[model samples]
Target: VFVCKKFLKKDGRKVRKAAKNEIMILKLVSHPNILQLIDTFETRKEYFIVQELATGGDVFDWILDQGNYTERDASNVIRQVLEAVAYLHSLNIVHRNLKLENLMYYTENNHNKVVLRDFYLSRFENGPITEPCGTPEYLAPEVVARHRYGRPVDCWAVGVIMYILLSGNPPFYDETEEENTDLHNRIIFCRIVAGDFEFDSPYWDDISPAAKELVCRLMEVDQMLRITAQDALYHEWIAGNGASEKNLKDGVCAQFEKNFAKAKWRVCIHSCSVNVRLNEVGNNSSRGILEEKPDEDQGLNVLLARNTTQQRYGPLKLFPSSVPAHCHSACPRRDPSTLPHFLSLDYTQMFKVACSTPFLLLICTSL
Candidate 1:
């Protein structure tokens, strides 16, 4: 295996950091579909990442020899590819560069297996990333546009891969050099619309509906609505399960719900604060009572109150009236004994407080 390391210059800090991060992410990821990183080293000029060599070479070479891969071959390759992607995304990593050339085939015990290779264009999910990289044909709309993108870019590339694998052609084309660049630019900005491609061939007739659905969903211009890698893992075609079995397993569903609950809680708290501020603008406001404009000392007190309340009652929903009561009741004038008891009350008790005080029970829910 040959490794490239010309990305370590002082001006290449970003590239170096990205390489290091890719190595770190690769080390943490283990899957049957991923090519293993055997070893790594660094010279002053570059970093070397040694990966297992695929004796059968890249998918592009294989396709060239065969002219076009059969549907079964495409399905087999795509299944492995998606499995690798699913595993990477589970670890919050995105393989931003995905194409036939990046897929390698190796023989193990005389059995052929496909593995995903290349990580120079990969990224994590911690923050915004704006590096323009990846081959032109597989570049996502957002990636081509030089916009901050996350894991969804990987999904778009997956769609492109699927298109090439099944149809033996890319979804977009240009007759002129200028038009080719313009088409790439348009793809980057998500200006290309779906249903623009004609697929009247008999080959498309045998393609499964699930596979087509997944491709369309993954290639969606709207990043927010794009199928996440995790969700795609459970997709009907990829999973080989019917629509009814497409739902996540019970345990997985529970974990998903838990994460959603936490996110919803944060949103609820933020919205509550905004609503409180808006309500404070009107007369007969409870916002003032909630200590909306808290001083330093009051801020500390409010933190203590929230901590104590959470410890005792879990997450307490601060209704309009409940907010003021919770904030004011924690004041020095209130009895210390009552404060401890109130803090110990559960979310149900907090809900009761909101219900009893109609003013506090606005549009807010326990979210």
Candidate 2:
């Protein structure tokens, strides 16, 4: 993965602690749906984590690349996610930061296999975890409120991920971009706290009620009543209805694409690392940046079709177009200028700064 050299540059101790936590947590887990930690090494100046190569890209970009996915596609993905989370809970480990970006496919050839990665925020839980952390949009209300929480937080994020997977947009999000972000955040927080959101048409019109019901249970505001990952795996929607592929209607696809395009900017911001990939996968020779260019707002698949990196990995051979102008090289490089500057903010302090400040500020402080 693309660890910023700024991590060691800031504080060697905290960096080492983070590395230990990641490695320890990863070592405890062994499942196909979870990303495997093969090895880890540290130079005097930086750290490098060797893990599974999710060549199919993350779920968000994968949706864009595939245009629109069916319920079966989303169900299969959610099943793997739930299974992984259940396994983690069985081991008393809580993945505090579970989002679309953290879930990826092993390869384009293996679309059904979704692997969960990023263990920096994960920890072994005995009771409540009081850490106030995680991505803003996916943060459970309890987390945002800075209350003691545990495994349920991951379940909440899974619900949000499932909603986006099926509909191409988050259930709880800003109503409009007119207001300043702080105001928008307040609105989002209030809705999440109140459990106020809807599966509005035409995105939800084509989606099965069983799927929506599961989402409702998972995203329940009351943590005590929310569905656990193990129970979620047995939901009818996940176990039975996901048996066949049902094509999404044309109008629903149009609506989802439109909504996703509007929210694409936020997705880009939350995607902390763009050029991170397993060296085991594609050709490591050609290096190119995947910046968003003006006058290129074509359908993702249309863009992929024209730019075919290869048949196996689709168009995003190097990186997704969502990658900002300043991130990893097409091929892995040790250039300090392209790396994110890591701030040694403690978890609680980081979360506070994240909620009140710009999203870019949050990225700047990413552990």
Best by TM-score: 2
Steric clashes per prediction: 4, 0
Off by over 4 Å in 2: 1-9, 12-14, 43-45, 242-245, 249-256, 259-367
State the local distance difference test value for candidate 2. 0.60
Clashes by residue pair, model 1: 5-46, 5-47, 141-188, 321-360
- lDDT for every model? 0.50, 0.60
In the range 343-364, model 1's lDDT, one tens digit per residue, is: 4444455444433442112211
Query: For candidate 2, what is the TM-score?
Result: 0.67
Model 2: which ten-residue window has the lowest total lDDT?
302-311
